[model samples]
Target: MNHSRAILTLAWREILRFLRQRNRVIGAVGQPVLFWLLFGAGLESTFRLGESGQSFRDYYFPGSFMLILLFTAIFTSISIIEDRKEGFLQSVLVSPVPRWGIVLGKVLGGTTLALLQGLLFLSFLFFTEMRPGLFEIGQLIFLAGIAAFGMTSLGFVLAWRLDSTQGFHAIMNLLLMPMWLLSGAFFPIPSLENGSFLLHWIMRCNPMSYAVSGVRQQMDGSFLTADLAADYWFPSLSLCWAVTILFSLLMFSWAWKTSSRRVQGDLR
Candidate 1:
């Protein structure tokens, strides 16, 4: 098979599989929306930015959006585990398709789903006062695609080594959930100024932090604007963009490297 055609076939299969799984759709999309309503409502009263007059809901909008991408990626990555358990992956592994194509096929599928769902949630901006022109929204959506690629690759790396979805869920709970929390998504980085130096630096170093900040910067006009009145806590947009791209690249490199290995390659 043509390499590009094979890759797209694998990717399309992933999309069809996800669409057939109705529970996954509801769980992936609904969980984040619930989090937004519950967290946003409960915290909006207590959380306020300086004179920007930003509520926690507005500040958290991008984070919630990111969560939608994260959840979709998680759901999609589980396909690796499922394929292995069902012996589908072993058949693919024996085929002539390049290992890198398998990696890209899987990651690209998840990235496509994540980007689409993230963009759908981005439409929620209409409900809010965010006044971004088409170009700006396009830029944010592009950033989201990059972030989704990185995150799905991260899941691929994790799932490639495991045969059990439970194990994958445990690790994601231990790693990815905290990753989002510290990504400056749950709260402002400025709030950590007087807090733990270790934690402050952790968030500063987290690539997801840069991703969330980039979204906020893009949406700055109305929601979580980077006006001078607010503390300068986020990394510069240039830096965020750089880190976001680098994060996706690094995670993908790791995913590809791991896929080249044979140990624990499948449940059989």
Candidate 2:
């Protein structure tokens, strides 16, 4: 089959598999909701957003949405390790499909799955009573899609070389979890008075920070504009988009190169 068809077929398989796994769906959606409610309520009184009086739940809505995407991307890409262990990935590698096609198919499959899960979390806006404009909602979804693609690609690259699922989980917990934590998802970049220069610099350097910022800026542009004196930190929307796009392309290229090496090693 042609590359485009191959990619779509692989992506469809991912979507079908996701639908069949009811537990995965429940965990992906449930965990974030629990966090949003438990933490949002626990901190609502104590966590203040300057003089604007926004509750912690209001501030955390975008972060909770991001957690959905993160979990979905991690879970979806873990299937690669399963496929490798089952010998399915090896069979695909030996097929006539180019290495890039294989990588693209798997990455796009995970990306699409992740994006869908993120969209599901968007429904919570109704509970929050947020009435963003249609254009704002569209922009938020577009940014979420790009962020999901980049995150899924990163997971794909990490899982590509691993032989065991346990190791993948460990690496993801150690790396990916921190990426989200430091991305300003749970809180604003901490002030220097409360955090060191190193901690501040790390958040500034994290690409996921831009992804979270992009989503938040798109969703809460007016609120953020009116609260200019607030201590919250986020890069400009243009810069966030640029960094997210560059990060996605970089991760995709790395995964493609890794897949090529795997094919070569298997053939030899």
Among all candidates shown, the one with the greatest TM-score: 1
Misplaced by over 4 Å in model 2 are: 191-195, 225-230, 263-268
TM-score of each: 0.94, 0.93
Model 1 clashing residue pairs (backbone): none
Which run of 10 residues does model 1 get worst, by summed lDDT?
223-232
Candidate 2 lDDT over 94-159, as tens digits, reads 788898888888878888888887888888887774577889889888888888888888888888
Q: Model 2, residue 130: what's the lDDT?
A: 55
All candidates' lDDT scores? 0.86, 0.82
**116-213 in candidate 1: lDDT tens per residue?**
78877887777655677878788888998899999999999999888789999999999999999999888877535456778778888889999998
At residue 26, candidate 2 shows an lDDT of 92
Best by lDDT: 1
lDDT of 1: 0.86
